[model samples]
Target: MFSKIDLKSDRFVVVFINDILIYSLDEYEHAEHLRIMLQTLRDNKCEFWLREVGFLGHIVLTNGIQVDPSKIFAVVN
Candidate 1:
């Protein structure tokens, strides 16, 4: 599925299994990138979860990506 959509990694999009993360420097670019991804997913007949989505156990937010505390603890222990 990822092969079908052409995106610059860590710039526009990142994919892992069924999970997909769409990102951009600003709102306008983010919207555009999201639209492209949604369209691609729709065309591919793939559905995405609006909630409960995370990348490598980390949450991607406007401020920055955060590692899950539980995951960190597990690694530390």
Candidate 2:
């Protein structure tokens, strides 16, 4: 559904699946560009947590980093 877009300017993209960061790239940045990229992932049955989307290299959590015991264990194993 999505194809790589070659642009004449510098842009960056970071895509994640199910709260786990997966892809990073430098390319075009536009609504359609993001849409197509997301649609392509959906078409391939990739899952995402819409509420968890955030900046690259950072994890999304309530009240900042999750330090609870249960949540920590669940994430680690």
Candidate 3:
């Protein structure tokens, strides 16, 4: 059901299972993208959540993405 909609490029969007993450270089672009993505989803009658994006063992930060400390402990413990 989700494979039909075209978002132009994969650089701005990431999809995993039921989660979708839309990102941009600045707040303005992000907002515009949110509007477009939300409208697209709405037009498709799809439900979505506006939550902080998570990448399992990876940490997401303002400066960059990092590996979760717990993941390293779990790996080497």
lDDT of 2 by residue, 1-77 (tens): 22232231134344333432333222333444456556445545644433343544444453354344544576788
Error of 3 at 58 (Å): 0.8
Q: In candidate 1, what are the lDDT values of residues 1-77, reduced to their tens digit? A: 56775455556777777766765677788668777777667646543433334579886655677887777896788
- Candidate 3, residue 30: the lDDT equals 80
CA shift of 67, model 1, Å: 1.5
Model 1 residue runs over 4 Å out of place are 6-11, 43-53, 73-77
Q: What would the TM-scores of all predictions be? A: 0.63, 0.27, 0.66
Q: Please count the clashing residue pairs in each candidate, in the order shown.
A: 0, 0, 0
lDDT, candidate 3, 1-77, per-residue tens: 35733444465877767656677888888878777777567546443343443576676666778787877996778
Poorest 10 consecutive residues by lDDT, candidate 3? 45-54
Question: Each candidate's lDDT (Cα)?
Answer: 0.66, 0.41, 0.64
Please report, as a residue range, the 10-residue window in candidate 2 with the lowest summed lDDT: 1-10
Residue 28 miss distance in model 3 (angstroms)? 0.5
lDDT of 1 at 15: 71
Q: Which predicted model would earn the best lDDT?
A: 1
